[model samples]
Target: MLDLRSFLEVCKKEGELLELRDVDWDVELGTLTELLAEKGGPALLFDKFKDYPEGFRVATDMYTTVKRFALAIDMPPDTNGLEIIKKWRAVDFEPVKPVEVATGPVMENVDEGEDVNLLKFPVPRFHERDGGRYMGTGVAIIIRDPDEGWVNVGVQRVMLHDERTLGLYISPGKHNAIIREKYWSKGESCPVVMDFGPTPLLFLSAASHVAWGISEMEWAGYLAKEPLEVIAGKVTGLPVPANSEIAIEGEYLPPDVESRKEGPLGEWTGYYGGGERSEPVVHVKAVYHRDNPILAGTPPIKPPNYAFAVQVRTTPLLWNELEKAGIRGIRGVWEHGAGGGRMLTIISLKQEYGGHAMRAALTAAGSHAAGYMSKLVIVVDEDIDPTNTNEVLWAVVSRANFEDSVSIIKGCWGTRLDPALPPEKREKGDLTHSVMIINACRPFYWKDRFPPVNRASEELRKKVIEKWVNEIPLLRG
Candidate 1:
C-alpha cells in the first residue's frame, strides 16, 4: 500500500528501522548488515559515506523480519509467516498492468553520455572475497522477450564494472536469462533497465518464481491490488518504476560482443559457489535518480540469515503445487533458511493410508516450487510442526526406517550455487543435483500400536496454562 519511502517511514514508526551515519562502504557497512541480520536486528539506513555525499544512501536488511515483510505487502505488521502465505494464496493473479507516466521523482536528476557515473553512490563490496563492488544485490533488471514482446522484471546480482558498465549474471534457465538469450540469438543487444530501489512488492515479485510470460510488475501490482506507476526509459524504451530511487538504462551485450568477469561474491548458499566467471555486461547509456537516492541492498550472507527473514512467497507456491498434485492432508510447509531456503523443505501432513507420507515426499521433491536446488524433503506427521526444526528432526529419528523411509532422487533440477555440487560437474555445466526424501511419519500399518509421544495432551496443557499462567509467569508466553 505504501511506496519505498513511505514503507521506511512505517518501519521507523514501528521501531524496526535504524539510521547509521558515516559508515565505510567497502566492508564495514556490509559487515554491520550481516551481524545485524544474524541477530534479527532492525532495518539499516546507511548515510554519509566517507567518499560519497550525504543523502546518497544504502538501505539493507529491510525484510529481515516477518513483521517488516508483512508491512511491505500491506498486511498487519504482527501477521505471521503462515498467515501471510494463506493471504497470498487467496489472491487472484490477474495482471494489473502498470500505468505509464511521462515523468516522476526518478527524473529529478539525470546523467547521460559522459556524465554518467555509478560511483557517486556508496556501492558496498559486501564480502571480503567479493571480486568487486555490487550495486544490484537488491535490484530489478527489466527486459522484454524479443519474440513475444512480453516484459520481465527479475532480480539478478550486478557487479559494477566501470562508470558506464555493469557485469550482469542471471542464473541459468531463469526467465531473464531465457529472454536475454532470445535477443542474443538474433545478434542484437538486449535492452535493459535496472531499478536499484523498486517498491517492496516489486522487489518481491522480481525475486519470486513467477511463471514465464507473466510480467512481474503486473503481478506485483495485482498483489498490491493497484497499478504501479511506470515511466519509459529514455534510452532503452523499457518501463521503469516512476517512484523508484535510481534507475539505469542500458543494454546487455551478447557474450560474444562484450563480457566481463563476475561473482566470486558471497551467495545465499553461504559459499562463493559460482566463483569468478565471464558474464555478459550491460553498457549503461543513461542514469536517472531522485535528488537524494536510496539504493536498496540485499547482499547474501551466511545461512540462517537470508535477504528475507522468512521465505514467505515460495512456501505458499510449494504448498499450492503439492495440493494441485493431489497430495492431501498437508498441514504445513516450511522452507528452512539454514539451507538458503530452497535446499531443505519440510512438509507436515496427516497420514491417511499406507505409503501416504512417501507419496507426498516424492511429489514435493518434484513440485515446481521445491524442485529446484532442493537437497532434502522431509515428510512428518501432523503432530510435528514443520517450522520447528527440532520437532521435525525428532520425527525423523524416532519414526523413520533407514531402508524404507529414505529415497534419493538423482539428477533433479539444481543450480551452480549448490555448494556440494562437484567441481567436475560444475566445470561440465552439469548443474543437476540429487534430492533425498525422508518419510518421517509413523508406520501406517500399525500406527495405533506405535509408541506415543510423552508430551501432555493439548487440552490439558492449554487448561493448565490458562489456570496457572499468572502464577507461573513463564507459561504466559
Candidate 2:
C-alpha cells in the first residue's frame, strides 16, 4: 500500500527531496521553509532534532511542486497541474472501502490517558503572529456522522493547546464541523481521531472539496486504486491509516461545552487574522506513533501550498459538474495553484451557440464544488490554455470588450476567511459576498470577423529551430 516513507523515497530518488539534519523546531525552521518555498526548493526532511532521538523527524513541502504532487497520486513524474486534472477526469473512480486491520504500526507505541504529550513532537511555530505552535499540518482528522453512519476525513488548521489538547479551526458548514454538530445537537460527544501524517493521497483527500456524504477515505482509496489499510481508533473507533507517522485519538468532549482561543494562523489566502477565535478543543485520550516517526508538515504560510493536488481533485469534479449541468464542449478547467484551489477558476470551451461561454461561466460560478469562495471565473476559447495566465489575459484584453464581457453579482456564496468582508458582516452568518465573471472568449456570432494571431506556423518554427541548432548558437549571450 502507498505510505509516507515510500512516497518520500520516490521523491528523493527523483531529486525532488532535500534532507537536512538538526533543523530547529522553532521560528528558524518555519523561516527557512518559507524562504525555500518562495525560491521553489525541494521537499525538506529535518532529521537530528536537538533534544529528541534520530528517528523522530519532520517532513515538509511534499506537494509544493507539480512533479512531487504527481508522485503523490501515482501520476507520471513530468505531469503538470492541468495534465494531472485531465488524467483524473479520465479515470473511473471505483469506490474501494478501506480495509481495517486489528493492529498496525501506528499502535506500535501508545501513550494513553495522561501520557498524551503533544509537545514531545516537533510541532513548529510557523508564522510569527501565530497564536502558538500547530501540530496539525498535513493531518487527516477523522470524525463520523452520528446519524448517517458515514465518516468524514478532513485537514484543518489545528493548534496545540497543551499535552492533551488541540484547538481546531473548522470553518462553519465544513464536513468536520457539520458532523460534530450532529452529535452535539443530540446531547452527545463527537468522537475524534487526528493523525499527523499519512500517505500524500490521504492528505490530498482530506483537503479536497468533494460532494457531500463522500468520505475522504473512499477518495484516498480511489486515488490509490486499492483499499487503504486502516485500523480503528481506540477512543473514537474511526478508521485511521494503519501506518501513519503519528496518531492522536480523542473526542470533542461530552456536551461540547469546552472552548479555547485558536487561530490567527496564516491561511491559504496569504492573509492572517481571518480565523482567530474561541473554537472547540479536542481532548486527547491516546497518542500513537512508530519508533522513528516522520511528521508531514504543510503549513499554509504562502501561496501554492499543495496546488497540483487541489487542481487534480477539484478541476475534474468541476468539469463533471459542468457537463452534468448540460454545458457542453468544456475543453479544460483549472483552479489556480497558489489560490489554494478555491479562490479562482478558469475554463476553456468551444462556443456551441450564443451565450455558451456565459452559461459555462455561470455554471462554474454557481456550482457546488467550486462556487464557494471562488472570486473570479474566466472563460476562454478552446484554443487558449486556461491554466496559462498570459493567454487568459490576452483573451481578456483582446477578445473581450470591457462593457460586454464582465458581470458582477453581489451576495453570492462567500468564505469566512475572506479578509475583504467587514467585521460585523463576518458575524451573524454573513458569509455571502460578491463574485465576478470575465467572459474572455470571442463573440459567438462574429467569429469570422475576429483577427487572427500573427504567430508563425509550427512547421516554419521547427525549421528555424533546426537551422539555429545546426549553425548558430541557440543562446548567444
Error of 2 at 426 (Å): 2.1
lDDT per residue for candidate 1 within 1-477, as digits (tens), equals 367878888999999999999889998999999999989999999999887888999999998788999998899988988888886664467889999999998999999989999988889999899999999988999998888988999889999988999999998778898899888999999999999988999998888777678898888888888999999888988998999999999989999999888888999889988899999999998899998899999999898788344367678878887887888999999888887777889999999999888888788777666677889999999989999999999999999987988899899888888889999999999999999999899989988999988999999999999999989999977
lDDT of each: 0.88, 0.82
Candidate 2 C-alpha lDDT tens digits along 304-381: 754555667778889988998999888888887766787788999999999999899888888877887888888999
Per-candidate TM-scores read: 0.95, 0.92
* Least well predicted 10-residue stretch by lDDT in candidate 2: 468-477
Instruction: Give the Å error, residue 241, model 1.
Output: 0.6
Regions of model 2 farther than 4 Å from truth = 253-256, 273-275, 304-306, 427-429, 455-477
RMSD of 1: 2.0
Best by lDDT: 1
